[model samples]
Target: MNRSPRFRTSRTLACAAALLCGAQGLSAQSTAPAAPTAGGDAPATAVLPPVQVRGHYDNDIGTSDAASEGAVTQRLIQNRPALRPGEILEFVPGMIVTQHSGNGKANQYFLRGFNLDHGTDFATFVDGMPVNMVTHAHGQGYTDLGFLIPELVRRIDYRKGPYFAREGDFASAGSARLALLDTLPRPLAEITLGQRDYRRGLFAGSTQLGESGVSLLGAVEAQTHNGPWKVPEDQRKFNGWLRATQRDGNSDRALTFMAYDARWTSTDQIPAALVENGTLDRFGSLDPSDGGRSRRISLSGSTRTTLNDGAWQASAYAVSSKLNLFSNFTYFLDDPVNGDQFEQAERRRMFGGELSRVWDVTLGGREHAFTLGLQARHDRLDPVGLYRNRARDRLATTVEAEVKQTQAGVYGEWNARWTPWLRSIAGLRADAARFDVDSSVAGNSGKASDEQLSPKLGLVFGPWQQTEFFVNAGRGFHSNDARGTTARFSPDGTESLDPVPGLAASRGTELGLRTVIVPGLQSSFAVWRLDLDSELVYIGDAGTTEPSGASRRSGVEWNNHWVLDDVGLPGWLLDLDLAASRARFRDAPSGSDRVPGSVDRVASFGIGYAPEGGRWFGHFQVRHFGPRDLVEDGSEQSSATTLAYLRGGWRPTASLTLAIDVFNLFDREASDIDYFYDSRPIQGGPAAEDRHFHPVEPRTLRVTASYRF
Candidate 1:
């Protein structure tokens, strides 16, 4: 790596000037004020202004329907070291985020024994807007968070089961909602530089509207990186955000706009034999042309009003996005002439809205709460297709189609407190969807419709000793890709295929406990099980639906958060989370029940120290992903992986801070993801079966500086 003396000097001077100005401001504020006089100015006495505390408690253990519901606040997000924006989801216990391709693509997510390919069973949202793309070209329920500006996040609320009436679709495994701050305490500008030619810049600010009860917030970000690959990644990205909020008494409304664009070259997974035989280095690529480009623009608005008894809320959003992905998974295997390269492309527009009302009442001397909600969404995708390509030129069109999808859902829930230590929640939801696809191949064009009714129930007992026990059960479902729902033939229109169900149902149950009995400690334990009606999915790569037997998964999770204020180490925090699970095909033969790629164990630990009025802060964290069977018969398995990270910061003044982050701190050699497959590297050669993997990045360091105005 080379250094730019001019850039370094400018940054240093800016930080120094900001710190100097901040110190002078602090000194002026510390000066004594005029004394207060009471009644005729007799013996005036100095009176200090009253201090107002501002900050909310972190919800490490939530008091909701399920023990798995919790929240991560800005305090934690600001202190953690994340190699990529999507890693923020790691705040969800037992959740692992890893990338198998380029930074521009959606990271692979695993949780509770489910691989959740590209956010399939796990739903994600940002500021009332959904991030998951339905009927996506790459995969169903595809989610990308690269557009997120982490500094704007206020909090992330997460729940690990489908036990709530407010959640629907792709939420069977879990859901996460990220909220952005409506205002900032001050304007800030930050610059970060790291190994492998990585650079990023961020600018954000907020201001009040004069006497209008309104506020405006704006942010912009630019980033570039050339990863340590045989062929440079050359990732470039830009993001922008704007929000306007109006507040009046107990009511508030906000309108937000966001935009993001990114382009990058990728190094897809490689054959293990190639690396083992020294034919290619771990950082080598099978195809240098593998890459992708994506963009998203959205506008959303939300409003809340306090009603006579409870509250009313509503939100709506519209988004437009485009994606062009090029991948070469098995070179010379499928198409020897074209080298097996393929492209997936799509252009889509989506609109959605949600409305809800909550009412509070007392019945028979007991308090009760009720909520009613409705949600609707629509997606119109044009020219979604798959094609064979050589280099970057398309050689043949496999499947090309236009799709329209619409969904409507409604639900109602009631919560009742029967006794001081007993509570119950019951809910029911109904959803209906319609899918229409017009394919370039006439035989595959068709329409399909489906509906489902889901019931939910939860019971809570005891707060005795600051511990609560919970029992929850719920039914949920995820919509299949529109193409899968209406397809009559394969991509080439040669082989006939049966259309899959429009919606696949899942049911789950859990028993859990949460405790805050120990001082400065919050902990939770949960044992859960889920069953899917069928393991059927639309394979984007092959452009067809594949059906499998029913499946079941059982898991246990334990999460703990402890603060060490009483141990003479104020502002020190520790977090530990562990999870284990078993996934099996319910209908499989006795000797082959194991589900492929289902991880059995996961763990994460973190420790941080950030004392009040101190000039320094530091954090260290470790994450582990245990091995798992690679096939239904359990003949092959993957090896476990562990990685560590360290972050430290020095606040020279109230308005200036410098930070450094070390990733893969121990220089561990590991794989981000792995799969077992057969491929032919040479024309007319016998196919070889082996484990394919994407190696994780080696040790890297990043330094950042921030100035506040």
Candidate 2:
């Protein structure tokens, strides 16, 4: 949609003004500190402890006017076993993470019935810094979480749907915010060894910097692996992190720096014909030279302070990254001599910031809350290109271009308690973006801009028996690749093409309930629907855009968490989650309702036994991914797959621990991902349409030893 520059500027300024005014008003009403208690006025300069929230839920369900929002604490992260760091996202309930290429590449994400192809519609953030890349060389929203150091993550806050005003682009399906710990409880050193030549080492620790109440923490990790592929993945990675934090009674501030680098050879997906004919194994590859290399460095800071009856928070970050990838999807289809191999490369720098204020006020004996937030981001990518290559040597260039993108957004929300049992939340958000591209092809260089305004509403009723009912509706959007909005010709400049819109809109509605009536059990159920204005997708492989018809999706999700201690089964926990959905092209012709690559069902179950101060702990978990349509006409489909994991640990002393993990516990033979497409084999024959797949890793065992000083 088109928006006037004057209107966009005014709205942003107005939101900023509101936030400042709220902060000022709260500060003016601050009360004097009370006299210190006990011995000698408690050392006049002592720092106050940070505020803490307790329990399995962050919000007081049935009382707070929120739905589908929850937090996963460090306790859960430490007790679970994940084959890859990206699997940590599985804690988001109903969301699934899988891989189609190699360990160093971004994980394929599926949620809310949408394939989400590498984070297209689901937003992700770490410590207030955006993780999704716009107009990327590989994909529009390519997000790689392999750099994350799981041990340093303090909590993960997640919300599904588009009901929160504070969230912007790429959040139509959902969003996740991860926060890291500013300090470690003690110095730690760990070593891990496993089958398949797997090895890893990690070191992390924190200590006081001086007498200024400031603490410093640092971490370093190095790992190598030759996965289950017959060609050997040969993956190597390195990561480092450092942070300094200061805290004083309900207030905290921190500065953090992170660096990561990785390189690996990928096996890619193998053709069904070859596997069935015994020409190649499931874990074999057509081109062993296919692989990728990537690196990222970032610095960020955040602070929060109390203001009378309210609080204010602010954060800023800067990042630089680079990627180079090689692949041969269609072995000999297009170029029989060169074998259709190509390379995608890009170098980028990004900066962003966010500010927000929250306060509570009483009106007519009823309490109300207000929140205002503002965000801004910019990206510069130079010489992003697509090139034809043979064994990593470039033969020809299809497209070479530079892109500069910027976005600004503002939002405000209000929560009111109409009565003891009724509450409502209303909000509005506005966002604007500008895209500029400079291409080697003369006529393809251009500039474009777009903006949007969205409104949100939610109503809640309940607490009669510790159950809450909610109804929510909102408008959300995801931005298109900047290159797509300005391109006038194909990558080779041989044919003319229409420029796609800069932003696509989506609308969603949800009806849900959350309950805690069973003492130690917490459960939630939600039925939701979403409609997209358009499905214009960026073809990363072709360096162009493809227009698809609009689509609609509806789904149901049920999640449960139970602590068995209250039920006479002490030191036990059980968790179960399930999701089912239907997705189709809106108003499509007969026999064309299916939305390709959309999954129809997903489920997960876990059981764990760990007692407080216990010497031994164990956990068992399973994940199931159901069938999916591979094409719009439903001419092809994929089979279901299930995998289990087991973990057992022993704490020999307060400062030492040992653990063992078994992945793919049952040694199941299944595909991690599957696609139906046309591709020629290395033997050089006519193009054949068949299923391509990457098989899941076989059963493997890993052991770890840790010591804390």
Candidate 3:
């Protein structure tokens, strides 16, 4: 019932598309090649900013020998609206987050045409502690991020791919490092009054408690909404965080106490018209008063100590999380008798802790950054399903599962500044993880554990201060649980479970170049190949809707950001940001190409205007996502989509400011999201190939006003 287009056929088509786009890009460039700016070719030396690991700025390029890129970047954090790091760089080149469940679905972003897998695609690190759980794929990525107020984040560095010493296992696609600043003081509050009795407000404050590095911090955000789909955003969010630390005057040996809480609840579900007709709200939706609620809370802390004559830093951290998800779903079916409606409830609690250390050892004239860390987590997931039968009898089935996993790794990276122009980092890690899953279901229940040794190596060459070339090779590993093949039956009473899902493993290689045309201009380009052999995705159970398989994805990405003609344009400045990517699968073990569901090729461009160091600013952005398949059945072709947004912001003084956010500029056609898996069977059968694209959200606008003192 399912006919797979030959790999060659799809690849040939992809190649043609890439060629066309490449030609168009070339045409867009000015007739004359860009001339090197004055002082752009400075000699490379200690004069240059340190070349750090992916997504890290404050952290030195110590022994953290990353498997891939070492592109040093500087991001301007001013006159911009950024709720989270993802917001500011959401439009960054070489990256995309095809999100679902609204923006709160923090973990559900897609990057480089790869699924965030909830939070598995990229792992976040604070200092040296891992924020993503070993049980990521299906669960929450932030886990308890709501508790950590984003307002407290000083800087965030995001990187994708290749292993390095500073990071550990599960850091496959990439990683992010968040550095929290304690001395900075930002106090502010804002309250908004809107239509449909909608109201929202936030309050935050931070101060240095003492010179020894003791600090106090607090923040809160809240929202409320009543929807008619006209002003369709009935949601509420709150976040609070506090911290205290004592450090030696030399900035070493620090003991810190950290605690935070984040909770978001929304009662607005995607409207019907908003899903199909992104441009119209023709008819009143079926249920305008229905929606969903999501809440998550977390708390943790860490202690860092310096030993061995200032040659080492050691730390231990622990985090706990609790979450709730409630959804009321209504939809009309076209098949198996049509007219189907449902509601579901899900609750989860996960708690764990990790300890990590970094030892800075000086051997002769070279430095070695050695890392040994271990993480243990206990995840208890409870999923309940309620179904209505043909006779209108409501039947309920519950799935209770508890999973405990312990992961520990040892890594050592040696970055040799072998020459003024060339540097190399070679590192290796040995990781062992064991999973214990206790599920109420019988035959599908079992325990599986695996250990792996991942090797990472990278080389960077700076021909000139403005240019750097790099290469990296590393392996990625993740485990899968056997939980989807339960006794829950479909509306048609089709039994599940044919082939048990297996574990997933990956290995990849990447090469890239980053350069600065000048202090204010930056650019990067990378080409990579990933070999993913996945039995079950990290986000879902194996052998569920679609069969799992081995897959290969390789792509090229180019990115650039420039503060063009800054001095020439005066108050009117033009900054350009561009991204382009293309992907092709050399082999898809499963006949279906949906093994990895993400857009194959995509691009985005943004132009902005702002006061050099003033308070008010705005930007106009154009985002384009190339057409691609999500379900591999009949292409599941989603037309390429484009969206636009604008903002008017002002900061009257250092402590007070206000702004407005307008999304879907022209009310472009957009989708909320489609159900990932259709009820269609996976085995070759009459129903095997039937699938539908989940609907997407419609044009929406949120007016925001803020003040800081």
Highest TM-score: give the candidate number: 2
Q: Rank the candidates by TM-score, best first.
A: 2, 1, 3
TM per candidate comes to 0.91, 0.93, 0.75
Candidate that beats the other on lDDT, 2 or 3, i.e. the better one: 2
TM-score of 2: 0.93
Predicted candidate 2 versus true structure: per-residue lDDT over 547-634, tens digit per residue: 8878999999998888788888777888899999999999798588898888899999998877777888888999998988988899
- Where is model 3 more than 4 Å wrong at Cα? 1-78, 82-92, 102-107, 126-148, 192-198, 208-213, 226-233, 251-291, 305-311, 314-319, 326-394, 482-503, 538-546, 564-596, 612-615, 672-705
Worst 10 residues of 3 by lDDT: 24-33
lDDT of 3 by residue, 557-664 (tens): 766555544445433333333434433344543445553456666666665665455565676666666665656443555566676666676667765556675556
Better of 1 and 3 by lDDT: 1
- What is the C-alpha RMSD, rounded to one decimal, of candidate 2? 5.5
lDDT against the true structure, per candidate, is 0.81, 0.80, 0.46
Candidate 1, number of clashes: 0
Q: Per model, state how many residue pairs clash.
A: 0, 1, 24
